[model samples]
Each structure stands twice: as structure tokens, then as C-alpha cells.
Target: MNLFGYEIRRKSNNTASNLPASTLSYIGVPPVFQGSTETVGTIDTRGKAGQAKAYALCSPLMSVISKKCAAIKNLRLAATTEDGEDLERPDAVRTMSHPNGVQGIADFVAHIEAMTQIFGKAYIVRMESVGLPEAFELFVVPNLCVTENAAISPALSFMPDADIVDYTVTICGSSMKIAKEDMFIVRDASYDLNACGGNISRMVSLQKPVNTFVASYEAVHELMINRGMLAIISLTSGSGDIIRDARLPETESEKNNIQQAFRKYGIRADQFKYAITSMNAAVSPVSSTITDLGLTDVQKACKKEIADIYQVPSVLLDVEGSTYANAKEAKTILYNDAIIPEANNIFSVLNRIYGFEDFKVMPYYDHLELFQESKREQAAGMTNLVNALNNAVSGGLMTTEQAKTELLKYIV
Candidate 1:
């Protein structure tokens, strides 16, 4: 079906809440200093200096949904899938750098607000990391806390009588402009696929020139809020799609800096054993990825997932009157017995799996609906696809004559 016929507004009898500013505040990198520890990564460099690398990271800002008492009973985190049930333990790690070459934080935030269509008011965080390396390096300094320019406040969408977000949104310098729209179900995204209005698409597409867009509530603490880690708690009331473009220097430079920095920093061939290794960070990877692919008894899967979160191996999950309070208490027991003690015993092992020990407890995140294509990614994909197809044929995966046929099959 063609996408152009979609209308943005659907008339209603009630009034809408005035939307807030879209570009709330800006997040800035913490200033570098002479004594801070350097975070290095995995690449061996040709020994260069002064290359600028910038990336955005994200973390989940968790809070109880529907209440602020530090607890929400039976806060459903589990879901059933073909494979099994996903025991709802939302364990948030920091956002990894995105391969799409996405840069500025503003563009990142816009992508997130549009995602309310699927995940309802959940916990999230967005962050950006900028490095000025003559050669890319990944080095971490302990006790370093960075800050951002702005933060989104506790705002949820609500129509006069409606409880959910069914409207399209455009956020500009601290203002949120909303328009009504028609939508249809999409098997992929958690919410119905939002067919864009001419205005929404254009507005979303405009973010490339900038970074990501985020919330206004981050300023509750210091002027330079914790860039070390971030959390997003959105009460969007189901805000619909706001589009985003894929092209921007922000995306490319961030990755280039990280990849190159590590190469440049590592292979120095000396003893800094605990001296410093490489550090890799960037925007999170979001594709039309339905990962944790293919399983049976998704409910069982959920059970396992919760077990992993609590670090309570199945042998330990007492099925004795398993209530949520019991679940919470059980997790606490696991945390104290296995999780905490194990954490101390396997510090290095934890760092290897969890980015860094710090990241496991706290980090940053980029909040967005996962399946839609950002303009930047959409365009970059084309050039790469051509090269990929040619390489496939050269490797004898297909005949030269069959290359075009093979390529077409993958593009759509």
C-alpha cells in the first residue's frame, strides 16, 4: 500500500493537553583534564594523535510505573514469545555506540519520543560521549561523572478524556507540537506502524543536522547532570511516531573516534598492565531486530530471563507460592548470596561482559522505537549494500550474473 494518503489528524470531542518544548536542554561532555584516567580500546594504532571522536551512550532510568513509591507491585516485565515467556526483568546496560554514524544528542532524543507507540511509560536514559584523540583511545577514569545541557520533566500525554497517546508529535526548542493521525497495526513494532503526516516526517527528518532530542526534567540536580549515567522515565501516554533522518556527521565521527582511538592507544608495547586499555562507546544499535529469536514456551523463557536477572539459577527458584512480593524477596536473597559475593570474586570477568564494572550498575541510553529506519541509516544502507552484494558474488556465494537478483532480494 502507498503511504502518501495518510491523514495526520483525527477529530475528537475532547481537548488535548498543551505539549511542552521538544528541544528541552542540551547535554554536554564533561571537561577533560590533565589527571583523569584515560579509557583505551581494542585497536593497535600507527601512533597518531589529535583525532576527535564523539559518541552518545544511554542507560535505563528506572522508576515504578504508575506510582513514585520506589516500588510498583507486579510491575509486569515479562512477556510471552514463540520461544518462551520473557520474565520481565528490565536490566539496563549502557547504550553501545550505533553503527549508523548518528552523532548529536538532540537527534537521538527525537528518535526516542517517537517510540511511545510501543513501550509505554518506561525507564530509560540517553548519553553522548565525545573524545578528542589525536588517535582513538578507550580509557576510563574512575569516579568520573559527566553532565548534559537539558533534561525532560515528568510529563505524560493525555487528551481531555483519553488516557493514551494517539497523536503524532513534533518537539522543537523546548516545545512539543502534536498533530492527530491515523494508524494501522504492524506485526513488527509494539505499537501500530505510524504512517507519517507530511509535517511529522519532515520534522523528524530535520533532526539529522543536530544531535538527539531529550526530556526537560534532568535538571533537578546540578547544572551539569550525571553524564556518567542516565535514566529516562517517560509517561508519554502513548505518543505516536515522530520521524528522524539518517544522515549526519555526528554518527560517523563518534564511531571513527572510538575505533581509531583504541588502535592508537593500544600496542604501545609497554607495561601499564593496569595502565589502561581501550574503551568503546556509542549510540545503541536498533534495527528491525526481533532478537532472542525463535524459542518454545515463551512463558518459560520469561521465567528463565527473570532468573538471570536475579542471578538465581533455576535449581534455586522455589515454586512455593510464587507471588511478586515473593519474587522481589527471592531476588534480594539471590543478590545477597550469589550476585553480590560473585560480583566481588569475578570483578574482571564482570567488566569483560558488562563493558566496565561501573556500566553494569549505571550507564547511558538512547530511547527510541526499534524498527523504523532513521534517514541517516536508510541512506547509508544503500551504499553499503552495493559493496556487500559485489563482495558476496566475488566470494562465489552467487554468480556475477546472479548478483543483481541476490542484491534485490536483500534490499527490500
Candidate 2:
């Protein structure tokens, strides 16, 4: 017997009465009681699955965000000294190595980037904790553990009014339960305090724009096909009058022969004009003519909308009106505004897990030398300040030390 689309009873062996009392009670339980304490987690990944597929196949914007964010450098563990100075620790770097083969920081960043891009949040699980100063490996798990993987049990030791405080995660299709301390979670922006994990994807609010881009892309291809057809050939009547055939083809063979003839000489006027002339119709030469669809500008607009969704400069996508100098400025802005924040958010999670107070993962784009031009301009301004300070010192208006102090204000 089937109940609610599930087999509740099968022959004499598997029946509802044979199941546990707890399992039987779940059949009529309200959705609110499905999880503990009335707080529910968002576990459904269908949206994320669609987003991932789109990122993989339909668009390059997600990849651009992920790859650019993952290209961080100079991230290392550091320790704070008694003098309040931060010192990089090489020993700490080696501890970051994964015991599950050769995966390292790069692989970690790639997984994180992809997770954040598709799901808007990520969780790094520590694989083991067996030694002093605990050398452990980190791996990512699905974001929806509370809903998709395990049930939440209320920690009864808490006061009645206190929140659930902690959760134990269990893998589906398994019997083991994971301790709370083994997981480190980071979430994107959310208004709900009780939300298990929240994410704010760049494309989340740009659904309309994404649809427009896709539609415009398809429309452009269709327009191109029509344009190609019009460019290669033309079809016209001897007169702009409709031909009415009183006696149509009575057999399939006759119809096919007529179709073959039309396919051969119907499109090009030069091929069969004499044959039409031999009939009672006067032949007029017809050729393809260009029609303006203004599709180029429309497609450009659509591309710009897509770039805007990711805060990426359209020039990076080969959009027009983007100069080299402006593109350079855009690249700097892109790295500073969008990419760095994401890298910082991921690092925050790592810091919390490793209990590091002095170190952080920072996005490094200095190899691009984005600040060099600004530095040059600053140097020029500083030179003028120095020359003026020198004149003041030479005129005895200010002492050398005083001039130095005045110069330091602007230079520093």
C-alpha cells in the first residue's frame, strides 16, 4: 500500500505497524516539527544546481568571479609576538597540507570560490583532531547539513529560553554523527538570524537582466541566420501577385518533384528566369537586399547588462567604448571592491577554525602593479612639497627640523 507517494506497506513483511513508533508518528507530523526548535535550514540545492549548470554552460560571468577571486596570494599563517608584531610562520604553512593526498591551498581556494559562487556560502570541515596543537585536514561539505544530511537535536543542558546553541551533523545513508567543533561555517549576507546558511549571489537579483541577455543572445543568432539567408539569395514573384493554383499536385511524387524544382531555382532569380519567361509570366530580377535590424547595438546593451550583474567591466568582455586606460582603472576597482571582500570573508572562516588572531588570508593583485601609476602621481606631488619646504628652510622662515616635520605630514 502507498501513502503520500511512499510505500508504507509492502506485502506482509514491510508495513507501517512493523516500523518504529517514532517513524510512524512522522507521517502526520507538521512541517514545523520536522526539525528541532522551530528553526529550519535551507537545504534544497535545486537553485544552486541550476546556478552551477548556468555558470558552467550558459555564461562566463560566474567563472570570471570564481577564478579572479581564487587567484589570491601571500596568504600565510602568522603569530603575534610579545612586542605586538606579526611574524609569518613557515611551520604553520606546512600544517595546512591535506593528509588526503596532494591537495593544498590552491585547491582549497578553488573549492571555496566555486562554492561561494554557486551556493552563496561554504563550510570547511576538519577531517581529524587527534594530536596536540592539532594538525588537521580541511575539506568542504554541502551547505545544507541540518536539513539535507542530519536532524537537529536540541542540547538539553541549555536553559529553557536559550537557543539550540550547537548541532551534530550526520551523513545521510550512514550512522555516524559529527561533533559540532569539527565544522567551520561561513555565510553570505542574510536577514534571518536563525538561517543555517545564507548567501547573496551576484546573479540572485539580476534574474531579469540574465534573462534579457539570454533572449538577446538567441535573438542575435536568429537575426544572423535571417541575415545570412537574405545575403545569399532572394525569392520574388514575377509580379507581386499571389499565384493561385486551381489544380494542385494529386500525388506525393508530383509534389516532391515540384518541391525539388523550386529548391533548385526558386531562391536565385538568375537561375530560372528563362523558364518562367517561357510561361505566361513576365520575369523580374530579384536579389537580396540588406535590412537594418540595429541588432549590434542591442547585443552590446545586453552584454553590458550581463557584465554589470557581476560588477565586471564590459570592456573585459570586448565591449565597445572601453579604452585601455579606463579598463585598467576598472580592473583595479574590480579587484579592490568585489574580489577582495570575498577573499576576506573566506579567510575569516579559516581564521576562526585555526584560532589565528594575528594572521589572515588577503587577496594579492600587486603583480599587476595596479597602484604604480598612482604612486608615480603621488611622487610628483611630494617632490613639489619638498622643494617648497627647502625654500622655507633656506629663507630661515622655519628650521630644518620644523621643515622636516611639515614635509612628513604630506609625504606620509
Candidate 3:
């Protein structure tokens, strides 16, 4: 079903406190670099631009990174006991399934998409009434809520009397001013001293690699355009000579006649040729032999660098020469190294917010077919261990209870 049929507004009737922006003066955070919006992919030979422009310029870089993040977002989530045992989800967690036909996971994924797009900084403002947060809305921080082309002041205002924060500042174009308990923020924590906490977007570490990747592609495109434009070299008897026809014109009046001569005669037609001669000038067209740019090698290296940042293998990005076996191995590495770790990071923050002491929420993907091989290997290893324990018990090396006790370690 299409959810974009009409405008969706928050159902909460909470009003923004008529607080002044000056009250939140001390609560400051560094904003993302906001120069004029630029495009990197456009035909420009200048050096690599900033992160925002790189995203606009490099298609593959954006695809691979966003795809990885989205994969994490779409992974199935489950509530589990502290012991890592799956449990029935509580009503509080199940609040994601709104009666308004919006899926909680979908809304959450949308925010995550924004987060990954902007160096992994995402703010989710939860709307609450009577001390319970009911709904969530995402806002782009440091990038929006502009005043006179400059980013607005702090979006967060503190209310000491209520002991809760008032998030009543406009973000981007959204005007939200909910209580502190109702809002939850997640950031990548760049560790900049100027920014509040270590949550500022990492200026150097995050963007440098991405810039290199973008620059590599931009260089390749520029080279291709240069090759196309300078392919033909004109050799003339005199400097004043100009070749001016679909085939070479006899007079200066035919200067504008240059067009697609190859279409009229055909490519490499030695028998169908034209000659140009004048009182003191003659002209000949020579196709320059352009050297190969080794673009394939450069692209592979750039792609590998990108995969390294995401902890994913180049094979998963469909890097050339990847075999099926290596791709599968790469997928395993990606799941264990990148996706699961990211899932843990996301769930850890959420679990802290949910304040579940005895239980924790986690993304569960044991059901995914891609991970089945790992599970199968684990199961087989466990079965072998159990059999060995059984043999030990039968051989009187250990008692049945002792074997059971030993097996519990492996099971847990």
C-alpha cells in the first residue's frame, strides 16, 4: 500500500514551551560544514570537494555504503533475555506497529538511512504524553534549521524545573519542541572538543577515505572527456589552414560545414576519401593514438579502499574477477565483521534508552539464509563435541552428570 497518499502529521497535542533560544546558549554543538551546496559528479577538473559533494559525485561509493547501512536497517530485530535467549516482545517494544499502518521498523529504517547518509548522525524525536514516548520523528541536525543561510542556534533547550529537556527548536523545516524524555538522539561521536560530548562528526577520519574514492572516479571521467575532445589532431600545410567540410571544404565559405563525416561515408573507408588543397595550404586529419588510462586498476583499488572502511570485502561490491566462493566468504566476513557489529551498536544504544535491566533488544538474523552456513558449521561442531562427551561418559572417563555439565559451557 502507498503511504504517501497524504501528509502525515504527529497525533500528539503537546505544545512547544514558549522558551527563548538564549536559555540554551550554553548547550552548543559544532555544525556540519555548510558552504554552498555543490555537486562533485559534474564536469569539473578542480580538486576533490567536501563530503556532501563527494556523495553527489560518486555513484558507486554512495551505493555500496548506503546498501550496507540499509542491509543493517532491514535486518530482523528481536527482544532477547540477558542470556541471549529470544523472548516475546513487550507492548512497549511492539509500539512500532502503529494502527496508522506505519511499520515501526520502516520508520526506524528511514531514520537510519538519514543517519548513514550524513556521517551517521541521526536524531529521533519521540513524541510523548504523560511521560511515555509514543511516536518517533526524524530530523537532520547541523544541516538544517537555517537562519539567514546560517545554521540556527541550539535545537535543545533545558528545563531545570521539570528536569527534562525541551527540544522545541526547528530542525531543517520541521518545528518540534517536545520534552527531553520524548526525544532520543544517536550520533557517531567524532571526538571534536568544540562539539558537545565526542559526538561531533569526525572531520578527518571519516571523510578523507571517501574523498579519495570520489577523486579517483572524478579523475577517470575527466580523462575520458579529455580523450574524446582531443582525439583528432589536424596537420596543415600552413597555420591559417582550417578543414571545413563534412569531408574538407575548398573555400573559407564552407567553414561551418564541419559535421559527422563518418556517418555520410562510413568509418575506415579507404576508397571513399577526400583531399583538401589551396593556393598556399593543404590539410590532413590524423587520429592520435591515445594511451590506455589504466582506469580498471585504479577503480579496483578505490573500491577496495571503500570496502575496507565498511569492513566489507570487495567481492560483495561486485568488484571484477570475484568468484562465487570468495563472494560467499566475503559475505561471511561482512556479516561477522561489519553488519553484526553495527547491529550491536544500534541495539546497545536503544537498549540503554529502553532501560531494560533484565532484558535487551537486539537485531536477530539467524533466519537469514546468507548466515545459515555459519550456523550449520556451529551446529556440526557442537554435535561432535556432544558425541565426544557421550563417549567419555560411556568409557567411564567422566560420569553422565559430568558430561552434561561440560556440555553446558559449549551450549551457552
Put down candidate 2 lDDT per residue, 230-254, tens digits, no spaces: 3222222444343342344679997
Estimate the lDDT of model 1.
Answer: 0.28
Ranking by TM-score: 3, 2, 1
- For candidate 2, the TM-score is 0.61
> For model 1, how does the per-residue alpha-carbon lDDT over 157-215 read when each residue is reduced to its tens digit?
33221332432221221222222122111111122133221111111211221111111
Which of the two candidates, 1 or 2, achieves a greater TM-score against the reference? Answer: 2
Q: Give lDDT for model 2.
A: 0.54
Alpha-carbon lDDT, every model:
0.28, 0.54, 0.52
Q: Residue 29: error of model 3 in Å? A: 35
Write down the lDDT that model 3 would get. Answer: 0.52
* CA-only RMSD, every prediction: 31.9, 12.4, 11.9
Pairs that collide, model 3:
41-57, 145-172, 167-177, 168-177
Superior by TM-score: candidate 2 or candidate 3: 3
TM value for model 1: 0.15
Candidate 3 similarity to native, TM-score: 0.64
